[model samples]
Target: MARKKHTEMSFLDHLEELRWLLIRSTIAIIIVAGACYFIDDYIFNTIIFGPKDPNFITYRFFCGVTHFFGVDDTYACATEFKFIIQNTEVGGQFSIYLWMLVTAGFILGFPYILWEFWRFISPALYEKERKKAALFIIVSSILFFIGVLFGYFVVVPLSINFFATFQASSDIVNQFTIDSYISMIKTSLIASGLVFEMPIIIYFLTKLGLVTPVFLRKYRRAAIVIILILAAIVTPPDIPSQIIVSIPMLILYEASIIISALVVKKQEQNG
Candidate 1:
């Protein structure tokens, strides 16, 4: 293919560039996915099932905290968790392997994917803007991983414990489908990771003059309501769990407001 001149590239040229970027990003994901496939036994047995065990670190820590508080009546003193996952289809295991690998690919290749996105957009931006955006891919990638960990270790375990132990009818047993269990884990991690990037998202929106600090502040009460709703949705229906989930998100909202304000100030100076 003939390369377009640097100063004469058309919209189609840009689209062609984007095509290569995606191809490279997909290659990176496959490399990481292959590694994940090899270590999937450890990943599935350890990290994925870690929360289902009573000896999970979170449970132990919660037990210790309850002891330190001299509260003896809580369910945190449990010795073993009482839930089992059952695969209901003949090809379920094979399907799960494929799904897990793809998810791992997306997670591990996130930084490269972000780089591709940046590359596709950077040519249209000013040098100053490009410099600012260069670090965005890195920062956002880190925040996403951190958020995934937080969700997997903190929120997912808590939810599993609560729902696993809660009894609705004396005759009903809790034998959860493997697909359902895995879906919950995947959803929690991915959702929280994206939620944790609010400040970064807000910064870019501010740069584009799309969101303002005043707009965030003016809807403070409304934001609070929405945060609470999200908290209830992602977390178990307990006051402490809801509060724990909400605090970080609420903090993100405040940080977004600050970031937006700074971006606005910088824009004013430049204008």
Candidate 2:
């Protein structure tokens, strides 16, 4: 592909610049993570355990929906979940702290990371395109944070509650290890943030001619099925939960379609 030139920096020089970009990004994450380790109380009790509590915003919202529909069997309305998280290994707590801080750092440093990514790509874009990348970073960062919030508030709570309550035999008790719980939440947050980059992904794909409006339109049904399956994998296997998760993704898919169309049009104009 032909690339626009910013009129500076050789290939090796660019790599050197990239190395510094990475160094800065890493430094930012470590600084934020250090703060996270200190504020373990807020991170653990308020943010991490917030979903474990029945008063989570998702449960309350769904409970209200069920009440409005006059279907009174809304289990989400319950004020308590019957489950215990236990650490069977001595190192489990330490592992959870380590991973939790790492994930926290990633979330906190997302914007800086995006900025570094932009710095790498911007030189290859037109001056106008480079200027627009400021909006890209801002939008990408906001979408990621929104996805993190959604995962924490909706997906994590539902999955934990469902798994804890699931009982095929009376002989089994629901005792999740601290590491296991942290892993679940961490996966949810990271996966959600990555998935929410739909429009940006599509923009690049469009630029490379890898995706187009017609292709997306033709595969619309297949995309929906794939999205539902992905939703099921990420959230509890319940239909409502999957649908709720898939809705935002579908909206983002549509947004990606629009973004792809715009990029394609711009390319055609330049050509």
Task: Report the lDDT tens digits of candidate 2 across residue range 1-271.
Answer: 3556456778899889989998998888988899888898899898988888888788888889888998885476777777888889888788888878878998989998999899888876777778787799999999999888878877898897678767789898778888788889999998998899988888888877899988998899999999999999998878878888899999999999888888888888988
Candidate 2 vs. true structure, TM-score: 0.92
- TM-score of each predicted structure versus truth: 0.91, 0.92
What are the per-residue Cα lDDT tens digits for candidate 1 across 20-129? 99889888888898989889998899988889998898888888998999888357767766778999999997898788888888888888888888878776667666
Q: Which stretches of model 2 miss by more than 4 angstroms? A: 1-20
